[model samples]
Target: MKPICFLLLSTSAVFAADAPKPKPKPEFQYQTEGIQVSLPRADEPKVKAFGPETIKAAAKYLDDGAICWVREKTCVNCHTTGPYLSERPALARQLGMPLEEVLADFVKTVPAEVKPQKETEKDGIKYYGGSWTSIWRSIGLAEWDKHVTGKLSAHTERSLQEMLMRQSADGSFVSYGEVEIPHITTDFELTLQAARAVTAAPAWLSSLKDPELLARVEKMKAWLRNAPPKNDFDRILRLQLAYYMPELVPQPQRDAALSLLSSKQHADGGWCLRDMSALNDWHFKMSDTVVKLISGLPDAASPESDAYMTSFAIVLMRQNNVPVSDERIQRGLAWLKREQRVSGRWWMQSLYRGNYSYITYIATAQAMKALALCDELH
Candidate 1:
């Protein structure tokens, strides 16, 4: 009887361990554009139909968020308004939407003169004031100039020059020292975005006659050429840089990078952020259990392929001249078209510490851009 009781007890323990955990309740929720948006979860409703109407809906969603951020926050944020301005102008051009308010707001952030500012310490690391803000503003304004205005504005050029003032002695722009994955986290990633900003504007680099500004540009280019990417995110940024500055990334290196990124695409034709870089690599302060809970991936080793990474991968591939007819590109496009949420936004769980998965804002923006590049927005 005793031996039989012991076996039963052990079997019960095993069953308990294998039981599925309940889905995590959202820490917070709010209404945006009259739709209730909870913190990003894996179970958001997928749209049943996707077409021109859906594209227009997405444009409205993006426009509302960007204009609201500009009016209310009145700040340049990497996850929300920053990515919106960088990507949405192109979509706005296609959809005939208004972006004047947001563009004006960005121009306002550029200062008349670049001056030294005090550094603030967070988590024992000192970050220069306005460094992060300047970098994002440069990228956003440059993209607005490239896609919407067709000529660089004086304000855009001023923003770029101010960004150079924040450049570190090593030629890389310093970040906020927080662990916000795929956005503001590393010096290398920030440097690449700065490079993108400089190159995106038509003939901006060639137009530079100031020896000091030209020297700074050469310094940044040298860092880009010599600085090795620390992770897959950095690698992706480097691949993007290759498009604008081919000499930075040699042909063999570019092919290798492309192959590495292509290999990570899941069977469902999407890319998982976790698969691209380990959670530990991002240095999340939370435990694995808590991170998994918030990400809604309790049983799996990693989160599923998400809209942000999928759209990002698609855009990167397209920039490298991968045609819409390619199998990988087609599959990725299908996944993006099928995954639109009912709110006309693409839901992506934040890789940062907070409950507000604002990364979804950028995800939605990137998704629209990906579709446009593939000629799916018509």
Candidate 2:
């Protein structure tokens, strides 16, 4: 009887040890009122990424921006807004909304969803910045297709074709809004934006198969080869164009660019920003009134490690096959995670404008992607 009682107690202890512990409630960045995310997944995949803390932080940051952006109608800048556009649907799904319905809500905000509100430029281009809109609209369509009908809308087709035509004989497109030239930071950032538009709209491109479009793409790729990158930012964008459009950048150039970027990684495990003069020259070539109005930011720049650029560099490195477990990546992720403000924004200066709202939005959006993508990697 004593032996049997001891054995029974041991069995009970084993069972209790196997019981699951309760998970901590998600610490969202804002009140749990308007937008929310599902409880963190407790599966193998989530663990394989970062632990729950990092993901919850990301959810909070994204949700905080969703309402503000839609109401202000400022989530429209393609360069600053593009990553957020691509990331929103995934966020919607995580919040347990019917993916299709939530995505439909987002589609309503895209430029092509309604008619262009402004008149044609002197160039007879109704969307002087229409090319950038095409990029954003197509990115929306791409994200939407993953969860919905997967069919390209009629407006999307027409919009894409028109956007494609907006490209110039020199294989460049007008960045249009806020920027007067391609050298917003990198001489080729705007050009890379043009390539990114086509690369992102896979469903549209796959369906159309226009030979003329193909030739134009080849021209764009070749143009990149001929056009040298102006700075560190340019160098990375050129590398990314290669990553997205392999046929565009030759193997040697890709290898060289990657080497250059890898070598530039700081000892602290993140990348730094370029000199002030690089951006200040063309960027601050602004109206006196507007310049005076911009406050809480600088007219010059600094050589410092920036979250936005570091995240960007991390993505570029990872896309080129650097593992998430790599020390450089781990440090980069650590740098980004530590830098997040309690309010959920990452600190970074402006290349185009000194508007803190725009600066924080763009940097935080890009950093979120870097962390999320790194987390995705096994």
Best by TM-score: 1
What lDDT does the true structure give each of the candidates? 0.78, 0.56
Question: On residues 19-135, what C-alpha lDDT tens digit does candidate 2 reach at each position?
Answer: 996665445322334653232111212122343555565555555555444444444444333555565543443432322432444455444443433333543433344566655
| Residue-level lDDT tens digits of model 1 in 187-284 | 77778888888988767898899898898889988998988666787777667888878878888888888898899999999997777765555542
Q: Compared to the true structure, candidate 2 yields what TM-score?
A: 0.68
Compared with the true structure, model 1 gives a TM-score of: 0.85
> Would you list the clashing residue pairs of candidate 1?
none
User: What C-alpha root-mean-square deviation, in Å, does candidate 1 show against the real structure?
Assistant: 8.5
lDDT of 1: 0.78
Please, what is the TM-score per model? 0.85, 0.68
Task: Show how many residue pairs clash in every candidate, following the order shown.
Answer: 0, 1
Estimate the overall C-alpha local distance difference test score of candidate 2: 0.56
RMSD after CA superposition, every candidate: 8.5, 18.0
